[model samples]
Target: MMTIKNSPASQPMLSMTGFAATESRFTGGLLLIELRAVNHRYLELNVKIDDNLRQFEAQVRELLQSRLGRGKVECRINLKSDAAVANLTLNPEMVGQIAQTLAALQQHFPQAQPVNLVEVLKLPGVCQTESIDTEAMAQSLLNGLSQAIDELIAARQREGEKLKQVLLDRLQGVREQISIVKPLLPALISQYQDKLTTKLREAMQAEDDRVRQEIVLYAQRIDVDEELARLNAHIVEMDRILTAGGTMGKKLDFLMQEMNREANTLGSKSVAIETTQVSMQLKVLIEQMREQIQNIE
Candidate 1:
């Protein structure tokens, strides 16, 4: 039967970067497994192993692909033999063949130096090292890898929780800035209307229909009601996405872009210094959230 490790049930948000390592010792050698991951748009597995364990590379790749959905992941394996336990075994068939060939050569040319046992043993394929059970070793290495992956996931989850809190705090900051600007809009518009009315009375010395039309047109041009409405809607959508959490990085990123656009429009249309400051604050908060979102998975 094959054993497999399962991830935690309540999957919190995950960050794309983490590190973990595990080591195991057996009678023949020691095995060390290390896993490192960083943010990436898609899953990319890079496995490195000693030449002796090259045969296990495919299994390692399959295991990583199954466990991870997104990231640039690198898996490194190191195996070391215990000097006290290491031993060499001769291949009888190979040694016999080499001996026969050497004998034939000696008969043909008696002056040829007779090959000693040590030199024959040193020849290629003549001596075989004490062998490890490949299947058993592979299984042990896989088990160690599974443990390392589990640790990596836990680390990412912890970091992700921190990210979530930071995002929520920034979201609240955005809401507060919106609140500060909302009440100022109506008063700002009223002040502008009063000023225009007084200017027309002083300059024209009579109530003119054209002046009224000009005031209305100027008010419309500076109105930011549409931008404010869109900003509120984007904020609501972002809250929903964050609450419903699962691979929300891209969605949150798009929502940030929308929010920034609205803020820019609001700033451009602002007739009051208070409104301009609020717009700047909103943009700064959105930018901070965006920077954190890039690390989220």
Candidate 2:
């Protein structure tokens, strides 16, 4: 089981896709497996095989589905050489065709290579012979395919690791912005209160009591304390999932959206410039994570 801690890039990147395969052989046995994959909305697969190997399609599909979660994949199997030929094959049809053609050419060019049985047999399609041991080929292909599939999985895991690091870095950035905005909250509330008081003083020059009541009601309606608390809670959930490991892509994606929602709400409340900046930074980090989650399996 490969994990996200193995990529070299150390960043959240969602564009990687890879493929690999291998094979092995045994007595009267042949197997070739090819694996292909790419990022997509969900895990999808298509398995293709030569007409003779149609029986193996289900087996290959099951093998892939059990291990992968979120990519479009294709698998194919075929015999690289004809097994029916056994040790030697001769094409009578080709021999006849070539012999006649060569005789016609000799009429015009006397010096042309004379028609010869050995030469005709050596030509393409004239003789199909092999020392190929089908058992050995099959076993070798099965072993090769197993290795290739493992290679493909490794490639995907390496890419996933990079994505995880990138997300962590972005999360740290969001935390820093949150810290910058956190201390400003008390001062921000006081400043808004002061501005309200000033406005009330000018508007109610004739009557001060009426203006004070309006200012208090305005402050309560615009409060963003609840939104900030939820934002913090979402961040905790994200960290927990990352640390626990395993298939958490879908869960992480949902949490990212929730984080963005909180940020949006905080921004709309608009208590101060620092808070607004923090909200924007949170959204940016969430967006980056969302893109990378699509590639996780």
Candidate 3:
């Protein structure tokens, strides 16, 4: 089954490969979001964010799906507290708790080594960073993601333009190959009839009617006009799809298969070395275009 990779109708063809990263500062921390996309049959998303920001993963996925139509996308988010605002301050409550616990311990073992103030301060929860506002952080995260996605789509657009040119050149090559073979058909048939007539004359001096019938059969077997016509039609459709420029990956792929089938038929009916060469050239061009189309979205 073929899968269509959809892109915006108003936009040019897009390649499903790009990379973008954005960083922004919020109330208490800085947020960094990075997005990378590669070709895929469908839109697949993998989002990785800090444990504290896991709550926003669903939101990130939704945002990406809204902006992108197709690709395997990987998103990474990192949030770090600002050095100036995040300075660790002593926890007065924790300190008081520690003092009360120490006094209780001393009552039982008064002779034990006195608790070191430096060591006590090093204990967990003894120091804490300023709390961040979740709402503000979420806003910052979304904003950064939006920017990164914009950059990624722009990169894909540039890559898509290059791919479009490559496909166009391959299509032109296919036309050239078809041109080379069309003129050879009549001459090839004539040569075949002459060779058959010569053989028949040497063997038994066959009647003219019999020889003509044999020539007609040979011509019918090797005729490739139908194949050529189909090939031309497929080429025209491909060109139209490329020009229209939206969700064409699957359509172009299907056309490539059809063109390849016709080329195979042309090769099988080859009456001359020139026709065989043309068939091979056509296959090569079609394969090249198919390879490029795989990356299109």
TM-score of each candidate structure, all chains considered together: 0.82, 0.71, 0.87
> Candidate 1: where is the Cα deviation over 4 Å?
1-10, 89-127, 206-212
Worst 10 residues of 1 by lDDT: 6-15
| Number of the predicted model whose TM-score against the real structure is largest | 3
State how far residue 204 of model 1 sits from its true place (Å).
Answer: 2.4
Model 3 TM:
0.87
Error of 2 at 286 (Å): 1.2
lDDT scores of the candidates, listed in order: 0.85, 0.70, 0.91
Residue range 1-297, candidate 3, lDDT tens digits: 999998656558899999999998898988988999999999999998999899998999899999998899999999888888887899999999999999999999989998888998789999998888889999999999999999999999899999999999999999999998888888988998889899999999999898999989988998899999999999899888888886788889999999999999999999778888889989889999999999998
Q: Candidate 2 versus the native: TM-score?
A: 0.71
Cα error, candidate 1, residue 33 (Å):
1.0
Residue 205's lDDT within candidate 2 is: 66
Quick one: RMSD of model 3?
Answer: 6.0
Which 10-residue window in model 2 sums to the lowest lDDT? 7-16
Per-residue CA lDDT of model 1 for 14-93, tens digit only, reads 88889999997777788988999998888888898977789889888988888877889989999987667668778899
Can you rank all candidates by lDDT, best first? 3, 1, 2
Off by over 4 Å in 2: 1-16, 23-33, 82-86, 90-142, 206-212
True-structure lDDT of candidate 3: 0.91
